[model samples]
Target: MVEFAMLVIVGGALVAMVMIYLRGRSGFRVANPESGTLYVTGVSPRPDATGAQYVTITGNLTGPSVPGTVVYGRMAWDVNDWPAIGDLIPVVYPSGKPERWQLSRPGARPGLGS
Candidate 1:
């Protein structure tokens, strides 16, 4: 019984550690943000239940270190304002990490440059 108890405790600890690591990795974002341009590549054929469509966007990194590094992400866009192919949109991403980015909102402070 004691050995079984110990095994359970160890297993629980391992699960907790894995959860923490996974959460941090997905939630990680850099503090110093930089402005980048994202060109619309494609949009989902159907909208979700929320009436939002998944959009595929790709863009080249705009930093000296990762110049020309292309990054891609999928964003949920409103049905009314779906992006068209070849549309350019402003975006902000963490310095050195272009994979994590989001669309830039007007009047909101953008990273690095104003």
Candidate 2:
């Protein structure tokens, strides 16, 4: 009975690890210049952080114009220069009021200059 229990525990752990790996590897990139929509991978912030989180976006390029290319962009969570990770916030452009962009849990790919 002890051996069987140990085997089951080990197997469960292995399965859990595999699931996590797959989740991390399942992300892809999608971009559309016409609509100005860019889907990035690895943009999710780490758990536990304050304001203005920084995340690195990476993956293959998609959309009408850009295809099979790699790009990067910087997304600022808050107005502060240093934002913490895992902070679900909107990115405020320099345009004007009510002009803001919110990054999804797993943010989009980093665009140019990121």
Candidate 3:
């Protein structure tokens, strides 16, 4: 009877392990990836261990369709790459969502900055 109980416990543990492994194997999810233009309203940099600046940028969009949707996001980069206030920066937003955006230069890669 004890051997039967031990066998059942071992079998249940093996099944649980397989289920957990399969769950974690699910792949990466993609973002909405909509691109647009927005103005930089402000920037504040916080120093990191690598000496790179982690900047929090607030975008002020003043367009006809997207009227005044201010969004704040952070990016890690060299100080030279930081955008100035009132500068019209290339912004990528989530599909059907303007408030979720990332600021970037023209011809640069999208969805890298957060």
- Can you tell me which runs of candidate 1 are displaced by over 4 Å? 1-30, 46-50, 61-66, 106-114
For candidate 3, which ten residues in a row score worst on lDDT? 105-114
- TM-score (C-alpha) between model 3 and the true structure: 0.51
* lDDT for residue 27 in candidate 1, whole number 0-100: 59
Task: Provide the lDDT at 45 for model 2.
Answer: 51
TM-scores for candidates 1 onward, in order: 0.53, 0.31, 0.51
Query: Model 3: per-residue lDDT, tens digit, 1-114?
Result: 999999999999999999888876652222856556776778784454454577788876544356568887776656555556766777666565676665535334323233
> On residues 18-82, what C-alpha lDDT tens digit does candidate 1 reach at each position?
99999876655447888777655554554545556675655554543456566777756666565
lDDT (Cα) of model 3: 0.64
Whole-model lDDT values for every prediction: 0.64, 0.42, 0.64
The alpha-carbon deviation from the true structure for residue 32 of candidate 2, after best TM-score superposition, in angstroms, is 12
Ranking by lDDT: 1, 3, 2
* Local lDDT at 32 for model 2: 20
Candidate 2, residues 28-79, lDDT tens digits: the string is 2233212223344445455366666655544333334434344445544433
